[model samples]
Target: MMKRLLLVAGAALMSGLVIAQEPVAPPQVDLEQQQALRDAVSGTSRGITNVMRDAYRNPERTLAFFGVTPQQTVIEIWPGGGWYTEILAPLLREDGKLIAAHFDPESEVAFFRRSRTEFEEKMAGAPDVYDKVELTTLNYDPQLPIAEPGSADRVLTFRNVHNWLSAGEDKAALVFEKFYAALKPGGMLGVVEHQARAGTSLEQMIDSGYVTQTKVRELAEAAGFQLVSVSPVNQNVQDSTDHPEGVWTLPPTLRLGDKDRARYLAIGESDRMTLLFVKPE
Candidate 1:
């Protein structure tokens, strides 16, 4: 009995020594930074609703899949109401840069004439956070100067591919080509948009403003981006893809009425594709 007790105590001491040698989790943004996010960004801005559930359901993993780190420069394309911006700016504050690329005021199809002031106001109060972020405005002219070549470490576009399909595939293609040119040789372009099925017809997608994974890959690859990997962390498997109004028929933008609310609610958010692409190193 005495020998057994000594062995047990020795084992316990060894376990404690092992644990003490283990590495600690990396340092992170403080409570004030997180509070700023909660105060400045609305639930709607994060696309939160009973329908669009993933933003709230899995935020850290979602941001992680975008290759977001505390050490890389990131550009958010057309940050509508600065939803991701609010979280991203503060999180990247200590060691990285956040560039909010807004549409030029002189251009048509600009969604953020008033968003500028709102974003600036939100950013203004957090000088330490905002100091790490830069606001860049550019016109979407195909013939003009935009982001410099090999400039950004990552370029992220969320839910804007549908607009490209509406504007015409060629128009979207040019923008993507520009996205390719704007990245460093090994930079990433992370895209999260409404996902049509694997076999959805391109013509139908163009009409309804939803694109298939294949279509997205095709466009990105054609523009010199190599398909890297895809994450289904944001996948919504409940959707049946038969909505009368396409993907928008499901949620916050539901164009349909009470007749289909239950049905769409059952479908939850539209299935989304989280694609990662990289230029050749």
Candidate 2:
């Protein structure tokens, strides 16, 4: 609920603006909601492999950290392969809504086209789970907004910051502003992304598929979002963040192909930062 939107300014005020907060506290989840998330996470109907990755992804805690409940209008940006969608689709199926802002199917880029096709097929294949998922795309037109200005309670993006960072900071900032425009007053933008340690250069970040947390903050702040909270629920202490093929060198991607495969599997996924930003009321 937006009821407890305690607007307190953060210390690092920039250009007379400051990050606001609703207080940094662990999100409380009732037994019913907890059980519901667990059920969704453990559901066999979801992609079997996706379920296995919960060890690294921690969907339940991550969503709870974002204060996700069953009664909010949420939009998932670029839900490639619907990894989180498998969990989010059901959690909000009954009382809430999930609008997946995916890639343009009509795009000239082969990768974008394929990604959209696969996601669409996944949704089409799972009618019971995904029939209610409203699909949309961003940046195609100015007149046609992503989620109708100020309509969503939360706009979520997972492991996508690097892709945006690849397109230059100006473009990345604009993308975040699009999200800002999509959210309601006191709405949230939850970003879960592969993280580089502070001071990583933009070029290195883009090349490595990991973004520096500082850059992310700048982009969000530029988009007019207030930093609300950061969660270590997705952090991987084992990851060095200095990989040969970038984050893809880790499991789930494992781009190296037996080039120290066992070692990478042991290290698991890349270290990630889960940040919550608020569109101040």
Candidate 3:
């Protein structure tokens, strides 16, 4: 039947007659990228516990919104537990670079020292997945560059803004400027943090870990970045942002212990705001 149709079309063409044809469908997705993300996120290398959190974290969508590609240099700030590291490591292992700016291993604080040590151990245990990750550290001194100035294609931080702001707004603003300095012109800065209601004071933000979008914008703008977009992929509307322990009272942290545990479990993760900013070219 195909041969017959071809012959008819040829004959029609020879006779100077036009033939009707079906329109080709345009591609709706980048199959290559989709498969890459799927393999990285769903791979057996990730911890089962981290995989279970996929429902709320939505790593795939969040990374996509940040315009992460396989070939760009990405710097992740404060990779405490290496949860995202599991996904990012394999994704960027083959072609791109994943620079983890983690806690200082020599910090006077015991938690920082222990966490960094454990993170190194985790990487050493899984060389096939994590060997290529270039490890670094982030600190309060904005002058201390995380990577070479204007070197990274993307700078990402998850649920870390409140910690920076805890010291004060100046510290947070300086850190934002550092993130800006580490990215190439027009490169992106992706942030995910617990969302606070508008009018929440800076003191409340420092205490609760929930920051207003307005405050985030102010910091980024101070750092010379323009807010390009915001995503709700990680948002939880059920959160009223007034828990006794703030965002920590939700699942994952559940800082309340067994008290009202069921209620916090039902609420799931805290309401989060995901923002993407671009350093101007």
Per-candidate TM equals: 0.74, 0.89, 0.88
Which candidate comes out best when scored by TM-score?
2
Which lDDT tens digits does candidate 1 get at residues 1-281?
Answer: 99998898889898884233222222233455445434434333233442244453355556666656666778888776666776677666776778887666555554556667667776776676566778876445776434667788888888788777777788778778878877887788989888887787877786666679988888898898877778888788887666788877877668887876887877776778888888776
Q: Point out the higher-scoring one by lDDT: 1 or 3.
A: 3
Better of 2 and 3 by lDDT: 3
Which residue pairs clash within candidate 2?
none
Candidate 1, superposed: residue stretches over 4 Å from native: 1-57, 110-131, 143-146
Q: Please, what is the whole-model Cα lDDT of each candidate in the order they appear?
A: 0.71, 0.87, 0.88
Q: Mind sharing the TM-score for model 1?
A: 0.74
Candidate 2, 182: how far from true, in Å?
Answer: 0.7
Give lDDT for model 3: 0.88
State the lDDT of candidate 3 residue by residue for 127-225, as single tens digits: 999999999888877568899999999999999999989978888988898899899987889999999999999999999999999999999988888
| Poorest 10 consecutive residues by lDDT, candidate 2 | 3-12
**Cα shift from native, residue 103, model 2 (Å):** 0.5
Question: Each model's number of backbone clashes?
Answer: 0, 0, 0
Q: Cα lDDT of model 1 overall?
A: 0.71
Q: If candidate 1 were superposed on the true structure by all CA atoms, what would the RMSD be?
A: 14.4
